[model samples]
Target: MDFHVLELFSGIGGMHYAFRSAAVPGKVIAAMDINTNANAVYAHNFPTTSVCNNNIQSLTPEKIEKLNVNMILMSPPCQPHTRVGNRLDVDDNRSDGLQHICNLLPLCQGVQYILMENVKGFEISKAHDQFLDALRLAGYQWREFILCPTQFGIPNSRRRYYCLARKKEFCFDGGHILDDIPIEFRMGVIDGMMISNLLLPDNLIGPECYLPDKILSKRVWLMDIVTAEARKTMCFTKAYTYYSEGTGSIYCPLNKKEMDIVFAKVKELELSEESEALRLELLKSLKLRYFTPREIARLMSFPNTFEFPTETTNRQKYRFLGNSINVHVVGVLIKILCS
Candidate 1:
């Protein structure tokens, strides 16, 4: 099966990379996104492919028909349904683009397969019901999943919602929906290592990767700190470096004995300017740091070839990656969809 994909809300071409890695006979005919920063990165990586910087709402059936793509890959704006967001569902202006795509489904032609991903809470949203209605009205059969990278032994926990749909004429190979990722897709040692085994050597990591003494002393208690030998990491968000609690995991290179000693001294001090200064001094010895954007991309299953433009800032890279999909997980699904 040759897949000519129309990628919507395409951020940094994660879906395009997944398609290439899936070992399927496919190419993205055109990718559409309104984010200028994401558009620059996408074009940097996929120079031959068309990367349109246009709003989804502006798409017409005629425009879509001209592409004649058989598969549609999209990760709509997740802000409205995210746990930290306002939970506005379909009412949020950010979701208008997704609603526009749903409305366009019945009118567009040759789109036989559709795959969408979003935050976990999206399953219960009114927009999701509207999407199902559109799929049904367009004569498609569908299966939904809430999957995490850890299920495939990747060692990072970023649970997300995924939906795969095909025209009624086609059938899913075993056809029964499992609440979990199919057992056949489960594997160990993705891209040659789990997170525990993949920690980059200090020489490869830059000085900027280390957490500042200010952040270390203030939010030390709230951080989800892990060591190089740990098998798992918390979900990393766009707020990773900007915010402390619940945003993401921090790395500590110190061994158990050294880390314990630092905490022991912290316990002896009370809350005061003098104590805070002492605490900061003690915490500095532990040598804690954040996982670099490149490291986070590795955890998200993006290939080593993936690169942000030279001009892209660290914050920009984090935001784009946080909004992107797990390439390895999606590659497996793409194979399943084509099968």
Candidate 2:
């Protein structure tokens, strides 16, 4: 039987794409989000699925039961937990929607599987404790992971937390629990394994967007330096494109030679196609002109076919994507839960 899914905060259907890529017999029966632009894009892409354009807090358990869903997948907004905004505001309205998920858990009468994805820092929040408590009280068996995209062979180093919970009766305790799994279990699962593993090799592009030879040569050195202060580095959420403008940008403690080479590369190209086909291809692979909406979508592992509505501004698109979850990460959790 095909598993039916309900996706909450379903920005541009990244979770939908992940479910599809998993080759599982599943269908997204319903999706909900408050952002109209995101909902427009979601509805345009998923014409048949019921798109509920409303705040998640307004959704009642009875409403969700109408979908006949067997699984629920969600990535609630992370602004409250995100270091970019107010750090620990439990009262933040942006984080309020997460409470709705907790409230709705008991209403998921037929849902055998559930997954939640969010920023890594979410684990520290009191809201996370409440969420976990709800699941445990509901007799659900669960597992969580702090996963990095690079571990999954995605080239990018986006890291996020993923949780998979299932009704106790159907739970696979051995695979779902990750306390002391084998080394094989610890290995990152890349996207290519489930879908086409094709990725643009680093050399085939132009000089404009490429990391400079010096910086490339010293990547290990930079990594070592950053490792010493990873806690500080990981907290930064500046866009890569903003590095040139000196706005919200981050920098490694690279030496003058490395910095000069990196800046030279950044200055060489406009966001145009001429200076670098590789940059263009990379943008295409990631899907966007600059590192805004598309980069966020890429980090979230949304499929190339996903589209934004023409009616929506690019800025809004970027906001929605930034708040979304990495679907590939969710898909792996689902696979393990159902195995």
Candidate 3:
């Protein structure tokens, strides 16, 4: 049987792409997000589907059930659960949307499977507790993972929390979410997966794959360095394209000796208007440049067919990608459960 999905907080339809990539016979009947940029890209990419531009809290069970959706895919906002966030958790204004979803769970009746994703700290949050309680009340069983793309051999290090829940009758544990969380979970479960196995072929890897984004300036030294043979890069957060500090890894090709000299020179100079040009010139000499939006999308496992409108800025593209999911990694999970 084909699964029908309702994607909440469906930033750019990353989960929908994963479902298609996994060869799963399903369709996302409706998707919701408040970000117009994301919704624009999503609509351009997924022309046939119904996309909602409203807040999730305004959603109701009657409206949802009418669509004949059986599965729900969500990657709720992480700001309230992130360490840099206010730590308000369920109390945060941003979390009210998810709280509304939690409130709708039991009443939706037709939903049999759900997959929710968030940052590492979310599993320990009050929001987690509240959402789990909603699942419990709705008679759903779940398996949670604190999984990284590295585990699947993808050359990026996004370790996200995924809770795959299924209705009681669909699960062997009689709908009980497992509390015995493993310290590590690997994909390619047949022979036990390795990080080296899920890599992109060499031909597909880009030319400037090792250059750090030039925008790093003096702090360019802090960019997560990696080679093509290397198996990991840092997580690309929503701020990736616009900022270099904490967003994602840059492809810096500078050697240790050159990097040391560059940083030492930066440290020796006074960090004022006079030194700014010198620092940028120094970083430029090291061949620093941000990953093009396409490369970042490739790292996230989006297929080549995916494209953004010319009107979408590089920053906007990266923002959507940063908020998106890893297609291959998520596809594996989708197949495991729905197939």
Candidate 4:
């Protein structure tokens, strides 16, 4: 039977892409988020589906029931649980958004499956305990794994925690017993054979961001994958960010080849007067110009056919991408769940 999914905090439908990858007869019947720009992008990309822009706190069980959703996939805000953000009081309003979902869990009477994705640090949070309690009280069976995207053949190394839960009848016998599992489950992507198997040709454009000159100059001496016996390169996040910045006007490492590439691209694009002005201002800081939203969307593994509303600003686009789930990672989880 075809499953129907309801995506909560569905920024640009990353979970939807995962469902597609599973190829299990299923559809994303509804998606909800509070950001207008994100909602706009989701709508543009998924024109036939219903996209709600209201805060999830206002949603009613009756409304959800109407969609006949069999699965719930959520990626709640990481800010409340993140180390970098304001470590607000447990009762702080910032966490209220997440609390609302926990409260709504019991109300989702018909949902047979639930999947949540979040930062690796969520395992220690009180909010996570609360979430587990609710799932347990609901008589659901669940399992969690801390997975990195590289294991699945993606070039990125974003490590995230994924929880898979099912109603009692559908749960696997060993679902909750992860302690005895082999250490392979926790292996970083660099150790995975899949990375080499799916390695794209070197010509695939590296991230468009820029990096410092010192790092760029060092690249020449670094061994190529076939010749060099290094197990792994730098972490993807830092490398991508650094490369994107280096490619732009940030600090032109005094290297002729690198400078030529950046200057040529800048001239080729002939950015708008306003963008040029912003670029100049960014140059003053010596930090590489941030990736265009389109570039970010690509890095997140959204299809080229995916559309973003023309009305959204580049900065807003970056925020949306930053908030999105890594599509390839989600796809692997969906495959496991469906299998």
The TM-scores of all predictions, comma-separated, are 0.93, 0.70, 0.81, 0.69
lDDT (C-alpha, whole model) for all candidates: 0.85, 0.62, 0.76, 0.62
Candidate 4: segments with Cα more than 4 A from true spot? 169-292
Candidate 2 on 227-288: residue-level lDDT in tens? 11222222213333323221111223344355445445543543343445443332233211
Give lDDT: candidate 3, residue 215.
43
What's the TM for model 2? 0.70
Backbone clashes, each candidate:
0, 1, 9, 11
* Candidates 1 and 4, the one with greater TM-score: 1
Model 3 scores a C-alpha lDDT of 0.76
- Model 1 sits at a Cα RMSD from the real structure of 2.5
| lDDT tens digits, residue span 69-102, model 3 | 9999999988898866878798889899989999
Worst 10 residues of 2 by lDDT: 227-236
Model 3 scores a TM of 0.81
Best by lDDT: 1
Write candidate 4's Cα lDDT for 1-339 as tens digits. 678999999987888887886677889999999878788888988999899998888877788788899888889877676554665425556566667877877888888888899776777788888888888877787777787655554544466778878775433345442322233332212243322333233445344444444443344223111111212222223223433322221222234455445545544545544455544433333333233445445445676776778887655665666667777667656655554
All-Cα superposition RMSD per candidate: 2.5, 9.1, 5.1, 9.4
Model 1 segments beyond 4 Å from truth?
168-178, 187-193, 256-258, 270-274
